[model samples]
Target: MAKRSNGEGSVRRRPNGTWEARLYYEDPRTGVRKRRSFYGQTAAEARRQMREARERLAAGAPVADSVMTMQEWCWRWLETTVAASSRRPATRVLYESLVRSHLSLPPLGQMMLGRVRPSDIEALVLRLRARGLAESTVQRIFIVLRMALEGAVRDGLIARNPAALVRPPRIERTEARHLSVEEVSALLECARGTRYYSLLRLIATTGLRKGEALALTWDAVDLDRGELQVRATLTRIEGELVVSAPKTAQSRRVLPLAPAEVEMLAAHREQQAVELSRVGEWQQDGFVFTTETGEPMDPRNVLRAMTTAAANAGLSDVNVHTLRHSAATAWLEAGVNVKAVSALLGHADIRITADVYGHVSEAVSRAAMVGLSDSLREPPRD
Candidate 1:
């Protein structure tokens, strides 16, 4: 499909330090002439905005102008930009969820984009806070709204992002939760007969992200060398499982495994073989972990197993992530360098490791004191 040729758009600088680009087009279906406008902070931005709109028209997606309602703009932006971008599947899902649950509400849903004000966005934030939404959730809603309107600016649909002008709610600080060593053992014991037993054990010991563990394949494991590589992640998009590259370059790393974990994994492979042989329709997917018929494991199934195990063990608020944090905390408490811990966990930045695991555990505190005393020891010759 080709974009119908549009009239040459005009760009002009406004008196208020903003730029405007305008074009006139005839609606093909209605045979009515209409004016479309785009805006930016500079003449070049305005022109680029206009050009992108034309490209979208060429691709057969109509650009909703400023006259359209906020709801219409949200829907259009989601389909034309967010859903179509190169962003992660997780991110796309988050944006879509926020739009449906919050942005589509009455406050701004029916209001025209041209008439939206900073005050309107502020009201939405206040409303979300008043309704007892978590500070994190309220912050996320505001972020998505800002991003959606920024998409509007890029598409030349809105002159500015009002949400940008409005102050977003402050996000409360939080630390990752970790389980005690005894709690970890009890949970594993409870999960011993379950499908995710080995998986939970692997993550608790190795701190592997749930997605990374679910996507693991036999080829990535080196039992003899006592190492494994994180090469892919598993995610569900629109109800279908998809395997994709690691979220960051650092996420694709080789990690050393303990001898016990290696032995456990070897045993797991033997058991898996026995289980697969009993199923006549094995898919031979080669995943290190799989369903009984050899299909890739679903993350939801893993979560279910963890929830059941936690309940049985009398552990509260425990999930796959709790196991990961526990492993990191264990490593740090063992006097491992923060830098080494950062690499072991495939953290993109060392600061992320420091921030999440910065809280001092009793073991870490004692180790620190012992190390300090040794460094301050008197010279024997004196």
Candidate 2:
């Protein structure tokens, strides 16, 4: 008998000149003790396998066998680690989409859990790019694969994460499009007398994200204080509308209400009240924006409303985000402090504000230069 000093595992000669190695451990997940065995033709080979298992166990890693396929491990990881965790449903939905559409396919998926090599991971990236997938999408797919393999490492299924050794595709950042103040005002006016008028106007005035605006509740608004708090966001998760906390801590914030928005909201509230009165108990509450039936506004309908208004206003390619950017652009161009604008937009960092509205800053600088030159010019009478 060749026994480990810790008495956790042993290698022994078996019947008919073969060798068997055994490691005993407690299953943390199941809370039960279990035994795992390995076999080899030579005692030395059996001992080596036994030693690897013991080392993994000593390192606080699970001693599970790596016989599962990559596809199997990925699903297990999704169901147990991602879905079962405390992550938002939207995050889980994204992970699910990525795993199903990319990780659980073809040669990589069918391979053994520990069989993936760095080269195989690199080839997957190349194949995805060959299919003409956007670099961002390809980068996202690679991240899902990497996350799956990292789970495998934790479960003792693989010693190294091959995806970690591969480089992901680089993503190019495109400049965000936004409307000018005049265009935004025209869009708002076009949407006026329509149900989405107030919502669109609010976004342009406050730079609130569509989700954050839709998620706004009566409790979060203070008409007297002329303020509103962004506490949650309403988004679709797996096709079901869900109200969840803001995506980032900075996203949960308080914003001052411009006088125009305050008046707009007051009128909107009155209109909403009249509409809800007719709903006859089918009415839902706690949402600032709602459907005719008083339910939370479906995100799709919100888009339709916005697009219709944009088309009528002769604004092409305007989306919900355009309004937010338009508001930020207006703030930057009007000489508001960049930091103040960033806080108003609930940005995690001021740099993000500067990046998106960098053009606005340049324009502001040029205007200031003109003003300075004019003021410093010699008087004509001199």
lDDT of each: 0.86, 0.84
TM-score quality measure for candidate 2: 0.83
Worst 10 residues of 2 by lDDT: 1-10
TM-score of each: 0.79, 0.83
Residue lDDT tens for model 1, 89-139: 877788888889889878698899878899999888889889999999999
Ten contiguous residues with the weakest lDDT in model 1? 56-65
RMSD of 1: 8.5
> Number of clashing pairs, model 2?
0
RMSD of each: 8.5, 4.2
lDDT, model 2: 0.84
